[model samples]
Target: MASRKRPALARLTNALATPSQLQVSQALGLSGSLLSSLHYLGGSLIQVAGAILNIPAPTIATSAIIFHRFHLVAGFLEQSIRDTVAACLYIASKSCEFPLRPSVILAAVDTACQDPLAVGGKRIPKRKYTRANTETLDHWELRILTTLAFNLHVVTPYTLCMEYLVSANVDRDRQKTVAQRAWNYLNDTLKTKICILHQPNVIAVTAIWLAAREAELELLDGEKWWEAFDVDTEDMGHLVLLLREGRDIAIRERDRIESGRKPTLTVEDVKARILEEASLSSRQ
Candidate 1:
């Protein structure tokens, strides 16, 4: 079979099929590309939440799960993630003590996206997004899953810091230090490639720890660094080293790109992609 260019989508689908994607999402953060995919999911989540207006966290979670399941089943488009999110919100409303309708969900989705016809469109067929639609959903659900398999997510920097905090047996003062120090590292991550795919939890923590070290941000009154976490002191020490290594790699990559030594995906890349698409059409 001709392969799709969207490796991350494929990877994600495979992982989801086996429950491996959840492990990756929690452990690695997610690849740059997969995170890009999440923007749509997240945005849709937020949009639904906003329409509900300050929904309880549990209800929000329930609705999000529904949306996610739907997205996984049907991919993320019409009768897809967008539809799933809308349907989930619709379900949540009805399931709540207060009744909601399919029309209610469709309206909210239509209003939020400024695509008015989604709910009332004359041409769009109305199908019950229930067990009846399950078969159809399954058929389309795996579309992007395979494309995203290579880009499984993992534990994030924030979670790593929290883990360290829990194991540290630290007092209040030390807790403050850890939180602030961790924040610094997280903020830095947003500006760098390190924010892309989350590494192992150890890597995530080490990256933050290394950043803290470089900033010379003394933790827990400066004297308690060694005593904070019940971590192997030697292993902890390696965290500081990680920052330097990352910096070095970043600098080298930047230099290579600046000097045009790093190969660019160029006009040929686009041309080849276009021809590939054309060939597929011809076959069909």
Candidate 2:
């Protein structure tokens, strides 16, 4: 079973971003902080849009993963992030067999794009679903499809994580708590680049590891529990560290924003900036 799975894992490595590939956004003039904010914004948009459409969690996760992969290959400058979110959710909804109509997706995304805390606390205007808007979405959908080579078979860790929890030797009473925490960890990881950095199974194991440790619950084999799933100890440890770092960064950003030390950038602000930059470039 492990040997057979190795080939799929090997293929997934192709999707992983190399160091130079990670620098694509930076090269495109996005600072490290801004890049992280963009990632957070994309994930938030996916979650909110999915909720509005009543999409399932797995499909929502797939959408966020698609968004991350798209940005890695084609930097944020190449496409409007809001449009890409709509396109990715549409693609993932179909790929996950929970198809939504393009019009429905556009409505949900348009609603999700509004920011109530914009300049002077005014609500950002929601985009109308005009013919031109539909064309823009169609263009973005094609771009995402072509950029990802139409390979939308995303393998998320939700199922495997749940399966591992069922197999774990935790007490019945504490099982729910551990599972919920692990699931939350998995969701949190989606906000960061860790999803693209590690394989699904590795991520599942890391979440389980973190949850179990927090609950003071040991698995069947204790120290070697992950071996049953063919996970490397070092990789799991590294993932745990990455997860913590991602969480810490998020907390710091939240604190900074709350303290009014940093102003929050709305979708409208980003779109306007991108358009202004493009106009300047075209004139040059």
Candidate 3:
């Protein structure tokens, strides 16, 4: 018999993928809840790592996007998610023109990993940066590069969002409120798959839409401002709903932590739970 051939990989892009193009985790029979938890965990790690490294927000956002895209192509089970998080930050920092040394990136990741709140209240022991650790990160960095096919140019929603706000010409008094809310919405979307699903322009418009409604500020003299941007009304509505769901998840996670519950699921915790559940199911 002729040797079996592997399935063709999906063409990678900065945004958009068809529903038929299942993520690697989905292909592995992972539950939706487990995948969501992992996505949130990775994003949180990127945020904390960025803060510890004093990297800029744009670079942090790019890192989160790269992290998600990498997992979408190569499942969390295939690679160490924590190490990938550090590697993504390292690659994004360079791509975003905010380069940091690998040693510095590793240090920041170590500190971020030690945060109990970020890691679902688990006390992760700090690991010293040995030659082995450096080699591991270098390997992950190359994996990300090849998995993503060197598509590192990520266009974020922040600049588009600011432009839309300026074009809308909101009242000077409420301008800051609207801008801040819109920015927060953009950041929250990073935690979910919304970033990969919609184009940056669409996401930016939707963010402004929600922010204006909350501030009770009308844009473009109460006309259909989104129409001017050529944004579909239906897409805006869909993004709004997605953003709401992400916000709810964030709030619940926060409350759970504050209430002193067992803490939200970390990537490692979720992986272990999934394996245990699979074992139990197999026995049954």
Q: What are the models' TM-scores?
A: 0.33, 0.81, 0.86
* Clash number for candidate 1: 32
lDDT tens digits, residue span 190-283, model 3: 8777776777777889999888899888889856878886678888888877767666666777788789875555655766866765566567
Candidate 2 lDDT tens digits, 71-169: 887888767778999999988988889998777787777667663121122222344567887788789989998987887767788888988888886
Tell me the deviation in Å of residue 177 in model 3.
1.2
At residue 9, give the lDDT of candidate 2. Answer: 59
Candidate 2 minimal-lDDT segment of 10 residues = 115-124
lDDT of each: 0.40, 0.75, 0.75
The Cα error of candidate 2 at residue 237, in Å, is 3.6
Per-prediction tally of clashes: 32, 0, 0
Whole-model alpha-carbon lDDT for candidate 3: 0.75
Candidate 1, residues 23-126, lDDT tens digits: the string is: 43323323333322343333333334334444443344335433443334333223334444555554554455444555444444544443211112222224
Ranking under TM-score, best-scoring first? 3, 2, 1
RMSD of each: 13.4, 5.3, 6.4
